[model samples]
Target: MAASRMYLSAKRAAALDAELMSSGGFSLDQLMELAGLSCAQAVYKSHPPESKRNVLIIAGPGNNGGDGLVAARHLKLFGYNPIVYYPKRPNKDLYNRLVTQLSNLKVSFTDDIDMAITETDQILDAIFGFSFQPPIRDPFVHVIGLLELTKKPVTSVDIPSSWDVDSGPPKTGELGAGFVPDVLVSLTAPKPAAKFFKGTHFLGGRFVSKEIAEKWGFSLPNYPGVDQVVELPVDNEKL
Candidate 1:
């Protein structure tokens, strides 16, 4: 039987991540590779490439964006068309290689998100992750506006774009109003905000070991067989 799941706070989430890399001996690239691959597998299993082929991945400038970059590469290998819209990029070499890998795969990238959205069948909201906070800014401010206006199914990575990691969506503003994604892929473990998500929820990043879970004071369900991702039943849904 799968273990009972727990929702982690933003502070604990960051601490667990640090422990995974520092003490667990997992490299950043290794973790991102696992995360992005799991994300690709989850999306493929749920949406399928035959129906939702063209994916508009709105990547941000953080490690969250790096995950998207890695996901784009895997999605392509899975026979889906992935187009990336990375407005602001980090100066790190890891990010540079991710972009280069996507470019080498002949994946299309666009500066005009409007045009990209029009052409794509679905959207991947890899714009932000667990550590995000408060008021939106720059290109993303406009990007979030575009995402809200769209009818496309948005698959958010870790946390939905512009969402508070623990408090969930906004209260009285347009920042995250009615912006619930069609699919939510929670990495490592689900965040406290995941309670707000009503869509098909998937738990990926299947690398959490017994030690890490113990250290973090959390429990995680096992991934079925050799699968890198697993569909989690929302109590409201499977009941």
Candidate 2:
């Protein structure tokens, strides 16, 4: 209910991140850590450790990819075998550190996306976040096409890959080009594209300051007990 009332655009989300880091004293690394951990927790809650323990994480070259990398590490710790498929890795220290962390955890990296998809029970769509734009390029285009062919359930972090931050999914003839996630984990707050999501949705990122929430008019949801993630009720009519 509170999530439905607040929909952050790409610009607003960026501003919130900046404000949080500059004034709130939260580092980018800190946010990414919490975000990725929350995503892993969501997957663990949905599938559990006893069932469907294998996950395929598709990471990109941006902050979203970093989040995926972080999620892979946490997933491994949670007793799930997570394999990462990072075609385009960023040259930043943070990303490199994440890759190293995953490697240290013995999480293998796969070059064959199709094969990895077949072996895994669930897919983590961390290929793109709120910053992703239009006509998908290169290896990602091919990779996304392969993912579309699978019947496996996908859980997207922040926003679904290939989706417009403000306009939801891109039209592919009569259908949408983006991968429709079975579960969406929104970090900090729900983005505009989340309006199109019609599945289990969880709101993460508990580090947002009260000042930031009031300033941006973000309605924070209350997590039950000691849970790090809160499930939001989906509105089929809106979808």
Q: Which 10 consecutive positions of candidate 2 have the poorest summed lDDT?
A: 170-179
Q: What TM-score would every model get versus the actual structure?
A: 0.94, 0.95
Q: Against the unseen true structure, what C-alpha lDDT does each candidate score?
A: 0.86, 0.86
User: What are the per-residue Cα lDDT tens digits for candidate 1 across 1-239?
Assistant: 13245778999888888988998899999999998888888889878999999998899999899999999999999999999999999999999999999999999889999899889999888888888876788898888888878999889999999789898887766676757788888988888788778788898857989778777776667788998888887744221
Predicted candidate 2, C-alpha RMSD: 1.7
lDDT of 2: 0.86
Q: Model 2 segments beyond 4 Å from truth?
A: 174-178, 236-239
